[model samples]
Target: METNLNNQISEEWTVSEDAIGQRIDQYLSHKFPEQSRATIQQWIKQGYVKIDGNDTKSKFLLKGFEKIHVELVLQDRTEHLPQEMPLDICYEDEHLLILNKPVGLVVHPGSGNPDNTLLNGLLAYSSEQKKLVRAGIVHRLDKDTSGLMVVAKDGETQQRLIDLLKEHDIKREYVAIVRGQLSHTGHVDQPIGRHPTQRVRMAVHHKGKPAITHYQPLRVFKHFSLMKLNLETGRTHQIRVHMHHLGHPLVGDPLYGNPNRIAADVVSELKDLVRAFPRQALHARQLEFIHPITQQPISIKIGLPEDMEQLLEDIEYYDDLDTFDDQMDVEYVE
Candidate 1:
């Protein structure tokens, strides 16, 4: 291993006879246990890894006595500094933590949001998270979409959780209020990708990654329905995009939902309330997985946040009123 003034690291390795026929990325993962295989693959794709003075693919088969070289530019960690903030911890152990993330909290730092994100808060909450990638965040929720999230406290646990997600071993359930009434349970098996023109939004496209969401109606209202949703595959803005694709975009989804979709007969007050909803009416309601360290099954369920609860209550009230009015009209005609 060698390091220069620019903080770039260069390392070399010689393949042994016993390790013949191993994939380069797999071999590198074994050598650097702390780094993820995905990261190593990215390094290989970027021409940072070479075999026998030739750039190689991550899947390159290794032969005995081949010289491998790797160079990586270290990322400066100072940019993501710790910021003290409140955390809604649902469950915590030495290996992992289950958090109930609230609405309006950014999960990570990005272009406009350079600090004061969940990552920064995690850094303040646990110094050990600094050593883990993305502060041990295996998956993510959109800033306005609040719900449960699992965070690992160590590298091995992080890798295990990531693997569980990849294998769909983790069970995640969500609750949402959508713009249209649904009478039956259904599932959306579609693909989702970044919008062609709208860079900030996601859309259902044929060329996108495979995505699936199963949904059941909990309560059907005049113009809205409360839904129970489970993710078969976690894609970016997946539920929102799929629901939108079905023409029942989630209530209060600023990007994909249309306020005009509300039923004209819906009481004026309810219409105003629905239109004024501040964020997507979606929440991660449950999470279930096997504990990496304890080898135990873990399941957690949480109720709706205050705003969603209030909105649901209002919808129920107005829907019942509409029903009563219709009953009265029929009786009068009789």
Candidate 2:
């Protein structure tokens, strides 16, 4: 648990002879009162704290004075606290805004991702511009899905975008890198709903929502394939489920893809890069729509994030997935 200063991790400390027979979490509490005892215990249970370079539960008892280490991951505590995170903004106006959301940036606040979302950053940006948005977020992108996304600044704009989306006036096109070499063109017209047995994942449920994805092979890599995707109807996990149903899983999709499939050499030295490759490799490259107020056509394009860029650069590293169908296997572990 040695922390590297250059990496902004505080140097870890060890328990001294003066502290012995103290509970692991209790000792941590005594040292870091700024961090709550319960929070420390929770982090320990989440494997944030390591005992002798091994994972330990929060209640793991301490025998005696030991060279124990503590590594604390930062989490936001204040309500509506704004962080100045760098944003790749592509377009902005009085009623709407657009940006190239980098991979790993969650769109909205959720269970664990309350702070540091694109929403939080937008809120901060709007505050200075004398604007606010309590609602009006037209659509969402999964935390790991990078690319272009639009946010409505006001209620009227939001409603207009929603209507446009319903009427298929807003065209959202995505470029994805999947694990297999696909055909020149294909469409996955599958009904997607909550996976019957695996409630956490969406699948091609018999009584699912109508979902269709039109895909065209853009570039064929050795072991990977870049495909252009168009959504006929947007549902939860539409592209992911449709592609998976059609036997193509996005490269880094943690929930759907092979857990052990990523190349180790690409991110061998970067632990965060390896772990950060947890989300699906999907990016909304293009967003086109007619302006609600001006009625003018608006289009925006975003480039790949650093990780995706690097991943694409290393495509030739692996041999082409020639027997992709024969070797491809789908296990329903949802």
Candidate 3:
């Protein structure tokens, strides 16, 4: 039997005689087959599950005819109202969706942004998503960074995709223009965490989560370099912080970049143009992973956004005026 109370969905079941001596977690797993065993065990640990109205552990042995109860606390979905907005979907199927998120579009609602976010648009696109947590959003890109993102259509697939991300099965690649002349492939293996004093920014700290960013220069300009990057771990602001830590912050990065990094020899107009660029010159260009439900591989790639294309064109035009020299190429050493 099931019932709803306040914001919780309560369910109860009587253990059958055939199930006697089974672990509580095992029994509950049979009852809620859609949920993972870890999730069921977490519920037991959190005191959401009870046996005959008494809190119990997941290891408790279930006796015949014992009443098992589960209370699932629902997330606050009412706070987000659906709003119609255009979505740049790259691929879509019954199980998931891949979309190109534009710059300045907030992924979800937060302190100041309560609506008009991608989550609201997703709900408007498919009312079914309102039932899934965060509208099935498993990953995110910064508001100022444009890129590809995958959104699950169901809870089971959502959990699977999350597990894949944690296991580093998903591959995400990006292209960026950074303020330096990189002549070789390099990588930054660092720890990233919230800044000690700056609450809004992330920093490379010793006590932070492990993060690795591998980068190769696609084109080295006179002062700036266009690079292709891959992330081995996705910590918040991982790429931005790692690049900044390398003294090569992404061009036009508002938070971690220093405008003074521009070389003085650069022409005045080009310097102003680089400084006036609005957002970070980073774009997620490729995404590859195995479909969680279909067991097939999926790969999607997108061209550079218009702004980035134009920025690269401008840099090329200015760079042609300077004498060309072959930069020595070096490999990144751990």
Q: What is the C-alpha lDDT of each candidate?
A: 0.86, 0.70, 0.86
Where does candidate 1 stray beyond 4 Å?
1-78, 321-334
Q: By TM-score, is 1 or 2 better? A: 1
lDDT value, candidate 3, whole model: 0.86
* Candidate 2 lowest-lDDT run of ten: 325-334
State in Å the error of residue 197, model 3: 2.1
Estimate, for each residue in 151-233, the C-alpha lDDT of model 1 and write its tens digit: 99877789999889999999999999998767578899999999999999999999999999998877766778788889989
- For candidate 1, the 10 contiguous residues with the lowest summed lDDT are 325-334
Candidate 2 residue lDDT tens string, 1-334: 3334332234355667666666788878766543456667887888767777888876676776455656564543324655667877789888788888786787778789888887777666755322233333668888778888887765556657877988888889998878666756879888888888888799998799888899887667444577888997989888988877777788777767763565544334332343456667788889998998789899887666766666565563444344444323221110
Displacement of the residue 72 alpha carbon in candidate 3, Å: 9.4
Over the stretch 199-291, how does candidate 3's per-residue lDDT look in tens digits? 999999999999999999787877888888999899998889999999899999988997656888888888988988999999998999999
Clashing residue pairs in candidate 1, if any?
A: none
TM values, all candidates = 0.78, 0.65, 0.83
Task: Give candidate 2's error at residue 148 in angstroms.
Answer: 0.9
If ranked by TM-score, best first, what sequence of candidates would result? 3, 1, 2
lDDT of 1 at 154: 75
Error of 2 at 318 (Å): 4.1
